[model samples]
Target: MGDTHKDLIFLIPLPGGRVARVPIDVLEHYVDPSARISHGGEAEEEDVTAHSMSVDPRTGASIWHTDWELGQCDYTDENGFPQSAYAWHRHPLGNEYTEIYQK
Candidate 1:
């Protein structure tokens, strides 16, 4: 029979020798679905790798290190100027999840 688990869990290592048991759904909500480690507008699928994981002490949120960076948003400002957008990192328990974070 196929797997029947309701959700998959990921064991993420954190700073200070702590580990987080995060669910797949939480990961999907915090991580950008389209994010990829790219350069010159070309997606380097094979070379994509996470450098490290840590907690933002100020916010108590988990952070994932990667070469991928977020750029301007597709929509423009009131004067038709591009606006900046931020990349997503793993923050399973962070209370900042919004529609933008959804897959």
Candidate 2:
């Protein structure tokens, strides 16, 4: 019964030079509009992509960690199409999370 439209896509690029795109939201109701929703106009939901990497687990060394944020308000390319940004996560922590933007 909501007036908004939302779509989500999960992408995984394999080392074999192949990309897999999966629609996780359709598989499970992890997110619900009826649940605690945001009200602010600029408070639009966004989809996040995370990449994790580490040299050694025990030492937690030879490197550090990092992450990136791409909001719904971002641009794709020459076209005005809205595209998600590439998120880089150094450690395999958190939900590997992403946001669902209201369109």
Scored by TM-score, the top model is 1
lDDT of 2 by residue, 1-103 (tens): 3433445666854433467876765646665443221121232233122222222335533322223322222224446455554432122243333333222
- Give every collision pair in model 1: none
Model 1 agreement with the true structure over 1-103: per-residue lDDT tens digits = 2354546787865444467998777787678554433222444333333222333435644454333233222324468565444433332333322112223
Q: Would you estimate the TM-scores of all the predictions? A: 0.32, 0.22
Q: In angstroms, give how far residue 52 of model 2 lies from its true place.
A: 9.5
TM-score, cand. 2:
0.22
* lDDT of all predictions: 0.42, 0.35
Prediction 1 global C-alpha lDDT: 0.42
